[model samples]
Target: MASPDLIEQRQYAEAVLGGLNIRPFRVDLTDGLLFVPKSRIAVVRKLCKHFDWPFKVTALTSSS
Candidate 1:
């Protein structure tokens, strides 16, 4: 399981990414909400659970 903060963050992300059909990647915890479609979000989540760290599984995009 991820840390409390990490879990919270992940939950928030899942909620935010709902039905978007996006792909997320791990890029370091401090990196912020920047995801790339190259890895499975579930894999990342499982990894996070295994490593006990927050995972980044959302597509990174720029705001106009």
Candidate 2:
């Protein structure tokens, strides 16, 4: 189960992404990390920058 704060964060993130017509990436709220699709990283980064959302992009070793 996710914590209340995490749930809230996820909802907010979803709303933000949805508003931009961009799919949301899985988030590790506890670690303050977001996993976005490689193909959409540029758009996601642009939106995050425009919205002043702090984030970092890192390559994943595996999709699963």
Candidate 3:
């Protein structure tokens, strides 16, 4: 599936990613984006919601 064709949608996404100085990456499902900034994680989460995409945060324990 793909997002609808709309300029505003693109601009909003670009602004969000730009503000966080980060990028949205999707190389594969199992091998997801790595090392996204903690500060930018929230924005990523919100964008994922707005776009109806799944954004998952894997919690790590010190033992790992």
Candidate 4:
């Protein structure tokens, strides 16, 4: 389960990023994980920090 603070952060992040035409995705159902593209990481990080949300960057790997 996600904390209330985290949920609010995600809602705000979605609105801001959506307004900028950058689509964010909830990549993990179990954790309610949200992510933007690598190209937008800096902007996302900035927003997260400004909003006082914990942010981490993780690389995605494909299983061939």
Best by TM-score: 4
Model 1 spans with C-alpha error above 4 angstroms: 1-34, 60-64
Count the clashes in each prediction.
0, 0, 0, 0
Q: Candidate 1 overall Cα lDDT vs. reference?
A: 0.51
Kindly list the per-residue Cα lDDT of model 4 for residues 10-41, writing each as its tens digit: 67766776888866433342454446665776
Computed on alpha carbons, the lDDT of every model, listed in order, comes to: 0.51, 0.64, 0.48, 0.60
Candidate 1 local lDDT, 1-64, one digit each (tens): 4356865766655554444554443344455443655445565456546655445456444530
The C-alpha stretches of model 4 lying farther than 4 A from their native spots are 27-33, 58-64
Give candidate 4's root-mean-square deviation (CA, Å): 3.6
Give candidate 3 misplaced runs (Cα > 4 Å).
Answer: 1-20, 23-28, 31-35, 58-64
Per-candidate TM equals 0.35, 0.58, 0.41, 0.60
Error of 2 at 25 (Å): 1.7
Give the alpha carbon lDDT tens digit for every residue of 1-64 in model 3: 3234433444555566677667442212333322245555666776667775433533222332
Give the Cα error of residue 16 in candidate 3, in Å. 8.4
User: How displaced is residue 15 in candidate 3, in Å?
Assistant: 12
- C-alpha root-mean-square deviation, candidate 2: 3.6
Best by lDDT: 2
